[model samples]
Target: MTSSPEPTYTWGTTSEINSFIRHLNKSHRILALCGAGLSAPSGIPTFKGSGSYWKNHKAAALSHPETFEANPGLVWSYFAERRRLALCAEPNKAPRALAQVARKRKGFVCLTQNVDGLSQRAGHPKERLFELHGSLMDIKCSNKECDYIDKENFAEPICPALAGDPEQPSSFSFSAKRTFTTQRRDATLSTKPSRTNAHEEYKYKREPNPLEALLESLSPTITPEMRQVVIPESELPHCPKCDSLLRPGVVWFGEALSKPMFDEINAWIEKEKKLDLMLVIGTMAEVYPAARFVHLAKEKGARVAIINLDAEHTGGIGLGKNDWMFGGDVEEVLEVLFEGVLLNG
Candidate 1:
């Protein structure tokens, strides 16, 4: 016998959405999966849309081991710009609602693919929140030999050594109070023959030459006669202990999700036996492992609700009864989705 098609819901009225929200709040074990879309309402751009930053340049091009290996400066410059932008962004209503529910309810948990810490900024505790893709706020030593990861490192801007030029050293700027220094490697003021653009070096996938590497280790300074002066390796921000390059603490396209985070999610699914509800907010369910959560929740008998700006691409993705779609501004829709649920408390 053939099976029937899965049913999907699209609520049209406030009352209906409120009714669902009421039902949703009644769920004992709630799992929420959030993505880049969750931060769009906060003026941040998503990764795969028209206005997305990644659309202009292939995301895979700049975020990879090869790119970092070719020119650590370029990679660091890109991530430093991301860090700069994230520092200026604030959490929107969607995050606020998720945080409120997670905090108010007993069995609420969140798994997010965002590097931005908007969820945490919206008041979700670190323990209850699992950033499966890692975070921009966290910095890790790039040296494979060093096991140093600093969660407190919120430092911004490319180091002067890696700064582009005088006019646009980088999209961001670093704090002067924090001096760039290292004890592992000796650095001195030096110069070499001029060469190709740093951006082109990666665009063509060419290995950086010895002089370029040495220049990359020099800090940039601006003087009246010279637009930008190149200082020494003493200016590159290196790991305090190992004195290696510091990289953004994010799970790149080829990297695995955090082991602890994966364990926690698996344990939750195994322990609960029946996950009551799965709230998928703002994501298109594109990437893996984490992307499979919706299906897993459905298999485990949990109702799934997806809220995104576009619904056409989401409805046919194996959703079932009690699986609904809310297509609109996440903040506006969430205002109604959580109305009576929060007010009644």
Candidate 2:
């Protein structure tokens, strides 16, 4: 069978975006693919490029399956802090706009790489939304034999010990270049160190990576006293059904997405012949499998549009004749698209 001729795409200004959205409202089979940048306006940290760190550790170091296996307590502490923050974050205008449009449009699907439930919080229907990476709010048993999975667990750590506690005088420095203060697990003391502190306090010219420092502290050269900072296994979350440990339900580095989710995405592709509009929002399209979807959508004759901060979107390799690229703050660009449109009327 012959495929349709490729449509011509225009590089658009905010006004042009608004005009496109006006036309989009009358169209069917819209798909929005979202990433961590979608929630950045709500003060959530993204895991792309430099300057994106969580608890002074590179997010990649903390979000690996091997890291979890090596130090479950550390992994638990990290995710617990993430969940605590996510619970307080409200859905921003961008996702809410998508949700409102989905309500008025038919054959709308939202696929998000973010584990945060912001889209759902904004009233996107669960049936139409697929969180490609599993949600942080979901917890599953770590036991290979157990098939236990719990949704919306909202689990928090109970007085989990910190390896950087000041009183213990561990080998690692807690603060970047300031007097280290101890933070209690009960919300006492400040969590973030002052960024403007003078650099003289550091023991070395460059600060050590927190995860590497952690490993060094754990080595046999360290005295027995420093080991006390580690959290005991019992302090972490455990599976209720089998008494095994529980881990975050997110798809970690070096791990495959759940088979059911992979199958579901495949099924979605088959069901929609004309995925006329494909919105790749907030993600850099750097990861595998998920990154391939852009090519797949284009091959299926979908008009691909990318909205991200990365320079690659402006113009680079593999860009087709019918591919729109918008480089800007996702929320701001989306506001331009939805303003006086679905958001207002």
After TM-score superposition, what is the CA distance of residue 313 in candidate 2 from its true location, in Å? Answer: 3.9
What lDDT score is found at residue 25 in candidate 2? 63
Instruction: List the lowest-lDDT window of 10 residues for candidate 2.
Output: 177-186
Q: Which candidate number maximizes TM-score?
A: 1
Per-residue lDDT tens digits for candidate 1, residues 67-124, read: 5555565556566666766777889888998888877776888999888888998999
Task: Give the whole-model CA lDDT for all candidates, comma-separated.
Answer: 0.63, 0.62
Q: Model 1: what TM-score?
A: 0.73
Best by lDDT: 1
Regions of candidate 2 where Cα sits further than 4 Å from its true position: 1-15, 155-229, 311-317, 339-345
Clashing pairs in 1: 161-218, 221-229
Note the clash tally of each candidate. Answer: 2, 0
